[model samples]
Target: MIRLFITRHGQTEWNLEKRFQGSKDSLLTELGEKQAGMLRDRLASQNFDLIYSSHLQRAYRTAEIIKDNREIKIIKDKALSEMKLGDWEGLKYDDVIEKYSKEYDLFWNKPHLFETTSGEGYSELKKRVIGSLKRIIRENDEKNILIVTHTIVIKQIMAYFEKRPLEKLWDLPYIHPTSLSLIEIDDEKTNVKLHGDISHLENNVKEIC
Candidate 1:
């Protein structure tokens, strides 16, 4: 059996500003750091055999905080990075909606039909994210693993485990910054123990944007 503890990075400056941070990078806000500390406390007792994080600074920083003094090795991988937004990177939500109305609409409402000229679409994102996940599972069969990645990456991972179709990508249970999810895999069976859980944040569960 393999236990995977997956989490999204802490809230970033772009996240607070409602900007698209795809492929781009941003620093974690004060609240973001606090959230990571809280997560650290929440999982302090658990032991992780290995930690995999997105090469992006935001996710890597979050992983560092959660790892906190632990001796676990953190491996950064581009496959765990956020969906590349290309021209949409570093742009505000409304601006992207205004500048690329059709594509933006398709991105949010019809992700399965969404396509991008400069960046990757949902299908492309899913392929890489899921492929990385499978690779991790294959390499570490009976160990506890921690993966720190982006929102879309985590969502795609959860959707894969839930057997959800691309059309229902944004179903329910929003993936908040620093949220923790757990998946238990044994042989051919996969079980999701938690999805988009913010219990670690306790009363400080207000969404920034």
Candidate 2:
């Protein structure tokens, strides 16, 4: 059996402002750095065999902070990145809602067929994420793995494990930055033990400001 511990990168300036950071590289804020420190302290006791992170700076920096001197094999993958929002990458929620109402509604309200002008659809994102996960599962015999990625990817991973409908992916709980999710994987059984755990940054979860 392989236990997977997944976390979204720490909060960023965009996260603070509730902006769409899809596929765009952004740096973690000061609070985000503090969150990473808190996570490192919280997860110090756990043993991880392999550490995988998104290629984005936020994710890589988060992994670097968490794995400080641990000497674990860390792998970077673009397949685990946040869903690209195309032209909406850095736009604020309210602005996107007002300017691109149709597309925004279709994305947040009905995700099945929503596609941005230059970004990937939810279906395609799911495919790529699951494809990467399958490869990881097949490559490793049995071990604990840590993956640092984005909220959307985390949601899709959990959705895949629960065999839930793709359209209802957003029906799951919200994913906070620096939060930890646990999954148990094996040949016959895939279990989501925990989802969007931000107990490490309990006070900061709502204080993204």
Which one is best on TM-score?
1
Candidate 1, superposed: residue stretches over 4 Å from native: none
Q: Estimate each model's TM-score.
A: 0.97, 0.94
Error of 1 at 182 (Å): 0.5
Model 1 / residue 178 / CA error / Å: 0.7
TM-score of 1: 0.97
Error of 2 at 202 (Å): 3.4
For candidate 2, write residues 1-209 as lDDT tens digits.
98889998998988888889999977899988888888898999999899999999999999999998998988999999899888888989999999999998888778886876688888889889999998888887588889999988988998888887877888847887788889887778888888888787856354642
Candidate 1's residue-wise lDDT over 1-209, tens digit each? 99999999998999999999999999999988988899999999999999999999999999999999999999999999999999999999999989999999888788988988899888889889999999999999899999999888988999999999999888888898898899999999998999989898957654743
Error of 1 at 143 (Å): 0.3
Alpha carbon lDDT of each predicted model: 0.92, 0.86
TM-score of 2: 0.94
